[model samples]
Target: MKYDQIDRKLFIKNRKNFMAQMKPSSLAVFNSNDIYPVSADSTMPFQQHRDIYYLSGVDQEESILVLFPDCPKENHREILFLKETNDHIAVWEGEKLTKEAAFETSGVKTVYWLKDMEKVMFELMTQCDTVYINTNEHYRANVETETREDRYTKWLKQKYPAHAVAKSNPILQRLRSVKDPIEIDLMQKACNITEKGFRRLLDFVKPGVWEYEIEAELMHEFLRNRSKGFAYTPIIAAGNNANVLHYVVNNQQCKDGDLILLDVGAEYANYSSDMTRTIPVGGRFSKRQKEVYNAVNHVKKEASKLLVPGTDWAEYHKEVGAMMTSELLSLKLLDKADVQNEDKDWPAYKKYFMHGTSHNIGLDTHDYGILTEPMQENMVFTVEPGIYIPEEKFGVRLEDDLVIQKSGEPFNLMGNIPIEVDEIEDIMNS
Candidate 1:
């Protein structure tokens, strides 16, 4: 791992919280993500399952965490099963975690090798009446591939047909939504790294530069700051390309009067920070371009203030739509007739500003939070508002990561990153 070691107390605390919610004799299991295959000999990079990482802080593949909080054997209550390492395997691939190192990484004192998993699990399962299976139940989840967790779940169910099964997703969704102080600090670090990348591009972007070049510059800055590149696949859309919401083929050359929409972020310690900033290609926005940019910026600022606690996710979006509708009308993007004749389901502002204003942002880009529930304090979200004008050959978006506070306004994680038009212009020219 390129990032520094995190304090294990966070994981210990997370496990304690999760165990508190479990049924009396229930045991929960979490498996690490598989190192997927690319072709014959190649393999994609391994990403740790966030739930297991939250509980054990083990970032390696072929790892499992078993939480038997009510077990009679005290040492067996929290156990970590890791792939055993030897000198020969260490020479082939870098050293895997040793038993002592596993104990240090996670707070679990009991460690067993992968070879002993079945035997250990058999003994542990007999003591517990219920099993909690970790499943992907995030709102945006569209997983088709069967994960390592899925295989383990299948085997576990087949082996223990009599045990009661429970879903771990609901508990995790609620718990992971609210940010721990330590998690907030890690996300702040990611946002700070992203800020460095954005500032680097201010001077580097010229009229004729390729969109991919800007992406490269951001990658370089993020890596130097100990970030593991983007939180998601980056969208470096130049000019009309920005109209396509998920545009990632950054092959176009930025023209003189066009704007580049950079939807990018940096990941630190597997935590994510999401940001989007649209800047003028030639370091100066045209009169009409500035008008659209300011409107989006205005909407962004107004939308951010609405992210306080007790806000309903759906109602918050409806309010943002009303805010954006007024802005679009001011910009002449929507007429009075357009507003009067718009559908109740899809408002007039949908023509210019289509996507949602915000989403939960953390370990996953779209982190875990129940949309149906009221907003809570310490929840981090991305406030991104944009106006895509294909006819004018430009688009404008401004985004920031914010933490909802207890009483007042949410805290901006990217507060130091330049967003004001004057600040951006001065930095680009300086």
Candidate 2:
């Protein structure tokens, strides 16, 4: 873990909140993600499951957290099962958490080694009526590979046939959707690191630089700032490449007259910060490019205002679409008939701006939140609106992470980053 330690109170509160929503006598189990093997003895880096990390501040592999709020024994109510660590593991890999250290890190009093998991779990199952299983139910999740949690869940249900099963995702979806002040501060740090990476490119970018070069620069900044790396796959698309929403090849040369779209963010302490800013390769936007750029920026500003508490995620996109349509009509990209005859299902504005304007952001890039529910204060979201004009050989997108508030407009987390036409130009040309 390259990031700093997070406050344990956040995890403590998260567990308490999730347990509060559980049925009486119900217990929940969470497992750390597996260290997936690539080939041979080599393996991909370990990434702790966000849910487990949210519930407990433990960030190690081969760890499990069990929450049995109504257990007969008081110590059994909150327990942690971790892999036994000794001086041998310390010599080979690294020093893992010990019993006393685990208590300090997660505030869990009772800790057991993995070797005693079955015995302890059997004792717990006998005391609890229902078992809660953690599963991935995020809106954008497409997990094909079976995870450790999946395997553990399968075994748990099979071994304890009489125990009732309940899904932990629904409770987590509602709880993780809102952010605590500590989580917000951590995300702000991630965004600030991303800001450094973005600012580094303003003067570094010029004609003839490869897209991969820009990606490298951003990585260097993020790593130096204690970030493990990008929160997601980075998109350093240049020229027509920017038109492709998920373009990440980053192999093209940045031409003089083309715009480069950078959809990148840095992660700090497992919290994510998402930001997208398109800039000119030659340190300045052309007259027409600035026109479209301002339109996208204007739409971004207006959309942020719409992220107030009680707003619906589905209706917010529709409102953003209407706003984009007006901007496109003013840009002469669409006429009156294009909108009048537009399909209600697919509006005329879809031709240019296709993706949703905002999504919840925190633990994951596309963080967990029930889109059907109304927005709430302290919920973080990304306001990204773009116009991809492949015919014009360019595209423009401006995005910022914002937090919904009880009153007034949402607060912009990336407010310190340069976005205005003159500011970007001055920074690049200075």
Candidate 3:
């Protein structure tokens, strides 16, 4: 891991909270993600499953965590199963976590190797009446590929047919949504790294620079600042490419008069910080571009204030839609006739601002949170509002990560990043 070790207390507290929520005599299991294959001899980078990491802080492949608060033996209550580390692995891939190291990282005293999992799991299964299985149940989840967790779940169900099965996703979705102070600090660090990247790009971007070059500059800054890398695939779209919401092909040459929409962020210790800023490619926004940029910025600012506790995700979005509708009306993009004939399912603002105004942001880019539940304190979210004017040959998106506060308004995590149209222009020109 490039980042410093996280305080083990975070994981300890998280486990306590999860165990508290579990039904009595039930055991929950979490599996690490597989290091996916690219080809015969190549493999994609190892990304730890967020739930496993949340419980055990084991960031390696082929790891497992079991929690049985009402186990017969006290030591067997919380166990970690890791791929055994050896000198050969040390020489080839680097140092895998030793038992002592795993204990330190996860705060779980009972640790076993992958080879002993079957024996250990058999003992655990015989004691617990119910087994909690982790599954991907995110609102936007569209997973077609079966994960390592899926395979383990299949095996466990087939082997333990008599045991009562329950879903762990619901509990995790509620728990992970509320940020621990330590987790919030890690996310703040990620936002700080992202700020460094954005500030570096301010100096690097200018007329005639390729979009890919700006992407390079941002990556350089993020790496130097000790971030693992982008939280998600970056969107370095310039001019009309910005109109495409998910544009990631950063090959276009940033023309003199166009705006570049940089929807990028850095990840520190698996915590994500999402930010989007549209800056003038030539260090100066045209008169009309500034108008659109300010409009988007205004929407983002207004939308962020709505992220306080007790706010309903659905109602919050509808309110934002109304605000955006008014802005679009003022911008002359939507006329009275357009508003009158607009479909209720697809509002007038959908033409320009199509995506949701905000989503939970944390360990995963689109982190876990139940949309039906009222907003709560310490829940982090991304407030992104954009106006894509394809006909005008540019788009504007302003976004920042924020933490829902107990009272007043949500706190902006990316508050340091320059967002003012004049401020971005000044830094670029300087």
How many steric clashes between backbone atoms does each model show? 0, 0, 0
Q: How high is the lDDT of residue 202 in model 1?
A: 98
Give candidate 3's TM-score. Answer: 0.99
TM-score, candidate 2, is 0.99
Clashing residue pairs, backbone N/CA/C < 3 A, model 3: none
> Candidate 1 lDDT, tens digit per residue, 87-178?
99899999999999987888899999999999999999999999999999998899999999999999999999999999999999999999
Query: Would you list the C-alpha lDDT of every candidate in the order shown?
Result: 0.94, 0.93, 0.93
Q: Pairs clashing in candidate 1?
A: none
Superposed model 3: Cα runs more than 4 Å off: none
- Residue 231 of model 3, lDDT score: 90
